[model samples]
Target: MSNTIVANDLRKRYGDVNAVDGVSLTVEAGEFFGILGPNGAGKTTTLEIIEGLRQADAGEISVFGQSPWPRNPALLPRMGVQLQASAFFERLTAREQLRTFGSLYGVPGRKADEMLEVVGLSDKADTQVEKLSGGQAQRLSIACALVHEPELVFLDEPTAALDPQARRNLWDVLRAINTDGRTVVLTTHYMDEAEVLCDRVAIMDHGRILRSGAPAALVRGLEAAARVSVASGVMNADEARTLPGADEVTDDEVSLTISTRDAPKVVAALAERGALEGVQIKGATLEDVFLDLTGREYRA
Candidate 1:
């Protein structure tokens, strides 16, 4: 597949801090790519530069094989961006808001209305923007970004304020469009979201990318411990610790958990002892890999 985006040695600074330091990555056509980082990790800065909303102080960026800097008009119709916080024209109904956005690209009013349905907002079409709930507003922002049907879409923290069910619904909307061949790039705080939707992901911290790869591959590369658990009454902490390869064992009233490098040995031992009730084996996950790389400390 052809590259939809290629950024090389991108750099940016604000006063004394390096917001984006020597970052470079690529996204292929029709791929669902994710950028993950904690607060103050410079993910927003990097995305803005690539989206043509801001220019990098150093290095190069190309979207659709054209420079994104200088606000290239040629690339406008082919790209769409939904920022983390979206602003809408006051007093405009949801339908009118989408219509105005589509009109900017010379898209027909009918096409804009169709996008509202695509995003499951047809019922709220006549509701004013200020009256919509947080999740509804988020979906409207996404629909506006997609109204013109751009080939490349950028969504920053699209589901940040959504509840569980709403977030999953939005995921289905994006997933369907991506399957239809649009390239999507997203930045999000939720590790599970990235793991489920992104084909590949880049973990960023301290203004630079620490690792980039497919989620499954990155998790495998971590080589972290697997956790095995069973009902608490099935095995006491002391008995579980006696299992070969058990590194640590903890027992609460509800469950008994064993952390081990050799999950097979631990599992076999549990089976042999007839202590496999409610058995659950969980290997290293994307969240584990993320925490291992960026650390467990809180970030502002």
Candidate 2:
């Protein structure tokens, strides 16, 4: 498959600090790819460089086989961007705003109407943008981005502040877009969303990618060990340590982190002692993998 986006040693600096340092990745055509990281992790900066909104201090980037820098007018109409922050004329209706954006992209007015329908904002087409709720506003932004029927779309936190229902609704819309064969690149802090929506994900921290692969592969790569939690009401740590395969024991629970090869043996040992009553066993999750790699720091 041909890559739709590519970067090699992409670097960017802000005064004395390096915002993006030696990052390299690629997105294949028609792929739904995600960039996952906390705030100030260079996720947005790297995306901006690829989107042609900001210049990189060093390294190289290409989008759809063309350099993203220097503002390629020829490529503008083919790409859609829903930035983290967007503005519009407060008095303009959602339809009006989409129509205006469509005109800028040389799209017909009917195309804007179609996009509004696709985003489920046809009922609110006549409502002023300022009157729309947060979710509605986000949907409008997406509608505007799609008005030109772009081949590639970039969404930065598209469902950041949405309620569960609204987020699910947007996820359906995104799935539909991908089913129609458009490539999508999204950045989000929501790990569940990344796992469900993206075909592959890249985890970044401190301006560099720590790992990148399909979500399931990344989760399975984390030691392939089942976590067995046993709660026996404040058992002595030493007593809990006596259990087979128990590597770590806490005040309230004893965790048996055993590889799949030894899971059956560990379970049989637990069964021999009637320790299955309050036990829980599960495979590693994306969140678990994230914590294991990133060390659970509180972000500002």
Q: Best-fitting candidate, measured by TM-score?
A: 1
The sequence of per-residue lDDT tens digits that candidate 1 reaches over residues 1-300 is 999999999999999999999999999999999999999999999999999999999999999999988999999999989999999999999999999999999999998999998999999999999999888899999999999999999999999979999999999988988998999999999999999999999999988999999999999999999999999998789988889999999888888999999999999999999999999999999999899989999876
In terms of lDDT, the best-performing candidate is 1
What is the Cα-based lDDT of residue 217 in candidate 2? 96
**Residue pairs in candidate 2 whose N, alpha carbon or C atoms collide under 3 angstroms:** none
Q: RMSD to native for every prediction?
A: 0.8, 3.1
Question: What tens-digit string does per-residue lDDT give for candidate 2 at 153-265?
Answer: 99998999899999999999999988889999999989999999999998888788889999999997887567665565534456656767766555534443333335566
In order of appearance, the predictions have TM-scores of 0.99, 0.88
